[model samples]
Target: MCNHLAFWFGKDPARMDAMFRRSGLMREKWERDDYRAATIGKAIEGTPNVYDPNFGRRVGIRFGTNPGPGPGVTSGFSPPRSWDDPTRLAEDYLSGRCVRVVIDKCYLYRVDSDKPERNDCWEPVSDAWMQSDMWQLCVAAALQEWERKEAKRVADNEKAAQDAEENGEEAKQKKPEVVPPVFPAMVNSALLDTKSQSRLFDDTKLGTWIDGDPNAPHPVRVGNGLLDLKTRELKKHSPAWFSTTKIPAIYDPKEPYPVKVLDLLKYVFDGDDTRISVFQECLGACLSSKLIWKHFTAFEGDGDSGKSTLLNLILLFLGERNCSTISLKKLTTEKFAAFDMYGKAANLSADEAYFESADEGRLRELTGGDWVYWEEKFKSGFKGRNITKIFFSCNRMPKFSDKSNAIWNRLILFPCENVIPADKKDPIYMTPEFWEGSQSGLLNFALDGLDRYLSNRRITFSPKIVLAGERHRSASDSARMYLQDNFVEKDHARVATHLIYADYLDWLAVNGYKGQLESNMFGKEIPQLFKSAKSQTRDGVRCWIGITQTTSKEDLDFRRNIHPTNKERARQRENDSRGHTSYGQAYARLVEGNN
Candidate 1:
């Protein structure tokens, strides 16, 4: 019985009851001692009586003196007798002697509950019991109880909600909706997609508010409204404007600026008011390359003139990533070099090398907003149009091979003539620390320039700059120089076209000028110099009738001394009859007269 109880209830009756409760079995209120006693009593009282025919009508017989040897039992053999009577077995069970009773090889047992049998209320003790239908009943009961509790909980919740709604107390006790924080927009315009921009900003606005920084596409400091460039309408600002680009806190318009606008402009332009104005206008154009097309800037100065420093400040002010570096030589020599300018607001080159005359057409195209094809390494070529504003700084202007005025018309030169002495140079001006410290002031200055450019719609150049450009053009062309020196007005003595061409070539060789133009080219360019001059053929000789060769003092003296002899005059007349002069004879007479 103890072993059976250990296997069924895990060695303790209290544990058995706890397991039943956990499984929702609803254990009955009964002590283990009273249950054991009642179970043993029932088993004993239910025992049946046995009859022995050998005992001669006695139901249960005890072992008496056997009457000698019976007929069935020979000598030393006796009739079998019951080992113990049923009454004695019953007494042993009541006295607790026989704790367990076996009937038909099975343990005596009974369910202790007094109520009607509920198969669902019983839990299985082991695998054998689980295989029976009782374990399924227990599982079904557990699930049903769970469903009941859930239904009750839901009903209570619904009732509470209904009661609150009817009383109007929910409105008074409700929590407020939370609003997320707003931050500045910071993203490069080149990187942003149209969908993203539309979602962040209002589509209707007067003028597009472009943040001056090329690296940062989003506006960090904006007023209550912004303008739309495409629509030309004003729209209110939205708090949803957000981007990954980080704007420094110093750029806040609400904060005090570190440097005054005038002082900042002076620092960049070195107190040259003309340069300052021109540069500011250019800077404004750089802010929005799409608005202004054509026109590039050239900064002409030697080292230590602060031109490079000025460029660095501009790059810092505009976001360095928004600018790209490219050499003029590359722009002309490389087929796909223009690809580098894609998505860039400004392209800067310092100390650029000279370009051949062939590059002039490409340079014009770059500034003129023409579509150009470019290819990257190991990729297919594509066509793209760039509006990138160009800036070049060099010690001297590049020599252009094109004689046309196309290049000159588009170039705006700012002569940085003020060289900073070594003693007075500011070592920290170009340092990173200086850029970080003065970013706010520089941004404010650029904003003012932007406003001015938008208002005027065009940049105006000073007279000094115009003169400088002309000088620059003249210095590069030897043909222009030769014409200016040797050619005179129509009132002077006329020269034949062949003689002038010969003199020009000789002058080029003597001066060691490279890449001299051919005679046909010279003929084409001469008309530009003497606009009123016309060509004529006299006796089959080509001559320019209107223009004359300028007479130098030495040539005039030679002519004065040569009251040409009658012999020389006859020879000159004979040569004139042949439709051209014998230059050798004319020179020999002059030599004779000098002697």
Candidate 2:
């Protein structure tokens, strides 16, 4: 039987030569006759490359000096036919021999071809292939290997972090958790769990809550934990008042308070013991807002008298969020001005007293606890009672149209008299760090005052304070000055209302008092200054009795020379009642009496 190896090799020797050249396995010399003779000899010798009836032919081709079977031939010397087997092709990808390229989410490619122009050699690996039972089984095997490597990497990182922490080094920063918006009704306890708890305090009564016992039922909720106010140490928690934002109540109870009460008082009041006491009382009243109710504080002084410092200290004690800044003029003049005062425990004004006129009714209502109607731009008007304590630091005292003593009664004046010297001024005290450090001491001091006020229900003032208040009232009342300068006390003596009003206008202009009251308004305010006097229009001339005008030079000279003696005042009153004592006659009588 002739060897039919040519039929098995196919009738394409040139094609076989081209494949060998491309694979870099071409021999130096190759003739079809030599190839056929070698194959026939191997078949006859029953070599490994010889044909077997059960397993088919094992054909081996020699490429140069290295003898090996070509690609498709089933010979032990030939490389595995991975391109023909899908499992082998996938395995090649896992081994990293085949470059895996993700084309899109749904499809990927295993690129075996290096040619840029043609994609014919690229194998499309679809999501469908990954989802198939056979491919899934293959992927599962690959996933196990990958998971093992990932687990080792995670363990190594954790070990490194642990070692660093043990060595007192800063560990890697973890991702931050999201914070929720704070609610108004929530308890602001440092220990409370903010996420789980639906409520913090039982009721909305605003007060300080310090963490007490660990096991006790906490009265306030802070950041998702309950703060037991009964058993926990007060010093552990910081001092914080009710504010729009949450502040930690961390205060060092042991540290000495940096600011001395007497020093502060001396700085603000300039050794005026009267003003110092009144300021203390005012502070107490402000601290114990619930107990003291509606009294407001006013600080009047020249620049650099520590007015802003004193107010800033009080505001620091109250917490910045608990206070708002608004001019007293705005509150009394603008309709919607009170809106800024909502949720604030204190309202501060450092501006100069610019508003010459104020609505007395509004000022009264604010301090009298009447519901104040306030409106914001593009919003409906709302009404709320003014629980906020009003404080003002000004070069000039605020003026009001309401002559009734209601507004005066609510005001507590502290005259800042000590003008700080340029060389002695300490700017560090105004910094936030100084105030923050003193918070604990200041809070304790305020609490003590609050306790005293709660027990007594009164802010006591010194006799000097009473006198000072009167002086302030007199200074503020333009009519009081008019009464002092233009009128004299006499039983039958009277002053023309028009003349008195004219004198008042002149006094206002000379003293540089802003704004003017009409004659009728001036007449109305006179009764407030001199409560004993009564207005009467006699024969078309409006006059006030027992208050004679200094119409003549003799009357003016007598009024100016009159001393505060009962006998002399009585004689002067008699002379005035008798009618028209000329200046010359009065001088002659004085000279004659002396002789």
Q: Please report the candidate that would top TM-score against the real structure.
A: 1
Candidate 1, residues 1-595, lDDT tens digits: the string is 3222233333444433333344432436434668754643443344332111232112121221223675666798755532122222222222211011111111111122232221101111222331232222223323334445555666776777788899976532323222121111211111122112212122212112222233422343222233232232334332222211112213334444456445645754667677677777776566453454578888887788877876776676655545778887787667778776655667888886655455777888887767665566555555556557898888878887667777878889877777877898877777767766666555455556666766766666577578778777767888877887787666423456666675665566556677777888888767776777777765355667567667474643344334433345445444643547565444334334333
Evaluate residue 488 in candidate 1 and report its C-alpha lDDT on the 0 to 100 scale: 68
TM-score of 2: 0.49
Off by over 4 Å in 2: 1-259, 435-437, 451-458, 462-477, 488-499, 502-519, 535-543, 548-595
lDDT of residue 573 for candidate 1: 41
- TM-score of every candidate relative to the true structure: 0.51, 0.49
Candidate 1: regions farther than 4 A off: 1-271, 354-358, 435-458, 488-495, 529-595
lDDT of 2 by residue, 1-595 (tens): 1122222223234423332333233355534668745644544443223212222111121101223577777777655542223333233222322122211211121122233211211122443453342232233333333445555666777887898889998666333222122222222221122111212232222332212233333222222122333332342222222212222233344545456645777766667765654565555445432343667888788888888888877776665655788888888778877776764667888855755567878778888867666566555555556667888888887665556688777877776667899998888667667665565565445445555555666666656555656676766677765676666666655565654564565456555675577777777776676666788765455668666654455653444344343346446545643544543344334324323
Candidate 2 residue 128 Cα shift, in angstroms, is 45
Q: What local distance difference test score does each model get?
A: 0.52, 0.51
TM-score of 1: 0.51
